[model samples]
Target: MKIAVTSKAFAKNETLKSELQSFFPDCRFNTSGRLLNESELIEFLGDCDGAIVAMEQIQAPVLDDVNLLKVIAKFGVGLNNIDLSYCQKNGIPVKWTAGINRQSVAEMALGFMLMLIRNLYTTSNQLKKGEWNKSGGQSLYGKTIGIIGMGHIGQELTHLLKPFACRVLANDVVDINEFCEKNGVVSVGKETIYAEADIISLHTPLNTSTVQFIDATAFHKMTKKPIFINTARGELVNLQDLHDALLNGQLYGAAIDVYDVEPPTHKELISMPNLVCTPHIGGNSAEATLAMGRSAISHLVDSLLGAANER
Candidate 1:
């Protein structure tokens, strides 16, 4: 059986690559150090029976074209890039494990909150330019933190914030009353979160309902002019609206790890002094990378090996 690994991070791990090759002798790794485009991905997966993929869009056309593909083991939690409905219809099972990188993402979110509230990011940039600026900022303690999407990452972040003694307002489409009660998180609406939070962090996935979720209308509802942090999907926040919010002081500042485009093309938005940007490394910690890779490999091995026995 042939297996293809589309994640560069997964491919680079010698232990994982060796383990996979031992299991499936015909295993292939992507040597290109960049995210694969749609055509490149389809071509790479052409002769493989199974694949481990990350951040690549797998649509109906790709699925229709690739007949040998039987299973896709997702390297991370998010599934917005895959065409799930099409895969289901065609009997192409997608194996995934959730919360594998929850702690890693939560830690990054916590770091962003601390940096933004303490004005550390701006001060450090100023110091590099030979300017001595002593700007006192607010503490994370006693602040109202609004967390949208109380899933694995959100819940993990709430647990991490316990020492800060901040009030956590959580919102999710599904009911998580038990979890909220246990964690002392206030279950609230989106409007309430926007109006009351001193810092707003997003952890929602990208779907039809949540694409461009934070827009001009949402920004206008910010009564507290909160500092925004998005470690979630990039399309969740509108780039133009975020720029306007910073310009008009609708938000104190923002820490963005994800964007509408990876390696975002918006130079003005990224170059703003008030915004702190990262190249989507929120879940790429060494520990998290190993955990996620192992999980994906487990799913691939289980599904394919089990199916082979059945046949």
Candidate 2:
């Protein structure tokens, strides 16, 4: 059987490359170090039996052309990139594991919180320019933290924050009262969280109801001028609104690791000193990268090789 890996990052990992070859010698890997466009991606998987994908759009058009493709496996947690409806209608099995990178992402959010609170990012940049600004900002200890989604990464963040003794307020669409009670988290409405939190972080999934979840209206509701952090999907927050908030002082500061556009081109927003930006590496830690790659490989191995053995 042939296999194709669409994730450029995953394809570049030598460890993953070696491990995958041991199972299936005939494999295709994306080595361009750039995301393939629709036509390039379709041609790449033209003859593959199974595929490992990340961040590539696997919708009807791509699936329709890849007639030989058997199964689809996810390399990361997010499913918004893949077309589940199309896969389901055609009976294409998609194997995925959630929360594999939970610790890595949660740790990044914690780091962003610390950096934003202490003004580490801003002051460091100033020192680089010989300004020597000594504005040490607030501390993360005993501060109110609002987490928008209390899922795997959110729950893991709560565990990590126990040492800080932060007042954690969480709001989710599902019932989290029991978990909140056990962990000393307060289950509150989104309005209450926006009004009171000293630090606000988003960890929700990207869906219809959650797209543009935070906008100008939500920023205006933040009475505390909170430091904002987004390690989740970038579309969850409006890019223009976020820039305006940081510029108008509606938000104290922001640490953004994800953007609506990868390699985001908004120079005005990216050049802001108060805003710290990172190339979407929330789940790209050395440990997390290997784990996610291995998980995707496992799904493909099971769905194809294991099924072959059973037959």
Candidate 3:
């Protein structure tokens, strides 16, 4: 069987490559180190029987063109980029493993919070420019932390924050009452979180209900003017609205790891002193990369070899 590995990180890993080759023998990796556009991606997967993909959009058009493709095993947790309905309609099974990088993403979110509240980011920048600034900011201890989408990453972050003695306000569409009660997380409404939280972090998936969920109107609801952090999907926040909020002092500041566009082109927004931006490396830790790759490989091997029940 022929298989294509579309994730650059997974493709570059010698261990993962060898492991996949052991099962399939004929495995193609994206070695060019360039993010493939839609046409290029379709062409690359033309002769493959199955693929392990990350971040690439797999919609009806791409699926319709690739007649030989049988299955897709997602390299990461997020499935917003893939059209699940289309895949289901066409009988193409999309195998996925969730929460593989939960701790990695949670740690990044915690780092962002500490950097913003402690004034570490701005002070570091000032020092680099030969300016001495020693202004201290608020402490994370005894602060109200609002967490949206109390899933794996959110739960992990809550656990990490336990030593800090912060109040965790959690909100999720589905019931997480037992877990919240156990962790001392208060189940609250979105409005309450906006008004009360000292720090707000997003951990939700980007779906119809969540795309552009944090817009100008949401910013307007911020009575506390909290420090915002997003380690989740890029489209979850409106970049323009966030920029306006930072400029207008709607919130203290923001640290965003994901953007509407990867390697975002908006210089004005990204260059803001109060805002911190990263190149979507929240789940790219060495350990998380290995775990996610192995999980994707497991799904692919299980699905194709008729061991789906084991998975």
Candidate 4:
């Protein structure tokens, strides 16, 4: 059967193609530059029986057009990019690689927390410029870290933070009381987290209700002038509010990997020295990429072989 691996990043990492080919030698893969629009996607999938999608939206419109489309195996766990209910209704099975990069993402968040607390970026720059001035900074030892969303990533992050002996405040929409009790993470309300956290990290999924959860009011209410770390969905925090807070000294600093808009055409926050930005590479390490690719391919293989009985 014909297959299409439609991803902007997949074009660079040719290993996935090799791995898939090894398992299903007869399957043909057509590489597209990126996720295609409705009309473009229809044309691109021409005779493809299955597809590997990354960040593209597979709405009902595109799914309706693909007469031959079967499985839509996503590289990562976020299904918000695709329309799940529509896919289910149409019987076009969709599967996503789950928790493959949990440790990698958690590590990146921990690194960001340390960097932001110590002003490492600024200090490194100053020292390189022949200034040996000692810059006082905050320590992670006793800080209260509020982890919003206690999923795989959040749990891994909690493990990392535990070594530092920092107070962990973990909150989840679902019942993660077992994890909280075992890890000594205090499960609390959203208001308490927003108000008391020394450093706040967001790990929640991007959905209607939680979108822009951290807005101007939330930022204004933070009494600690907390350093914000966001490695998850960017839109969860208001970009305008963040920019305004940094300018007005309401926030200490911010380490952001994701953005409200990807490849932000005009991010005003980039101009602020206190704002450390990365182009959404929290889980883009080589190890993590290979893990996601191999895991997704394995899931597809199992599903096709009628071995995904438990799933």
Per-candidate count of clashing residue pairs (backbone under 3 Å): 0, 0, 0, 0
Q: Stretches of candidate 3 above 4 Å error? A: 307-311
- lDDT score at residue 17, model 3, on the 0-100 scale: 91
Q: Who is ahead in lDDT, 1 or 3?
A: 1
Give the lowest summed-lDDT range of ten residues in model 2.
32-41
Error at 20, model 4, angstroms: 0.9
By summed lDDT, the worst window of 10 consecutive residues in model 1 runs over 15-24
Model 1 alpha-carbon miss at residue 271, Å: 0.5
On TM-score, the candidate that comes out on top is 2
lDDT of 4 by residue, 228-291 (tens): 8899888898888889999999988888888877776446787787888888888878888888
Residue 34, candidate 3: how far off, in angstroms?
Answer: 3.0
lDDT tens readout by residue for model 3, 45-100? 98998999998888878888888888999987999888899889888899888899
TM-score list, all predictions = 0.98, 0.99, 0.97, 0.92
Candidate 4, superposed: residue stretches over 4 Å from native: 25-35, 127-133, 305-311
Q: Candidate 2 at 232: error in angstroms? A: 0.6
Kindly list the per-residue Cα lDDT of model 2 for residues 1-311, writing each as its tens digit.
99999898888899998999899999999988887888988899999999999888888888889899889999989999889999998989998999999999999999999888998998988888898878889878999999999999999999999999999999999999999999999999999999999999999999999999899999999999999999999999998999999999999999898888888977898888889899999999999999999999999999999999999
lDDT of 1 by residue, 1-311 (tens): 99989998888889888878878889889889888887888799999999999998889878778889989999888999999999998899999988999999999999999898998999999999998989968899989999999999999999999999999999999998999998899999999999999999999999999999899999999989999999999999999999999989999999999999988998888988999999999999999988888888888778998778889
The order of the candidates by lDDT, greatest first, is 2, 1, 3, 4
| TM-score-based ranking | 2, 1, 3, 4
- Steric clash pairs (candidate 2): none
C-alpha lDDT values of all predictions: 0.92, 0.93, 0.91, 0.82
lDDT of 2 at 1: 94
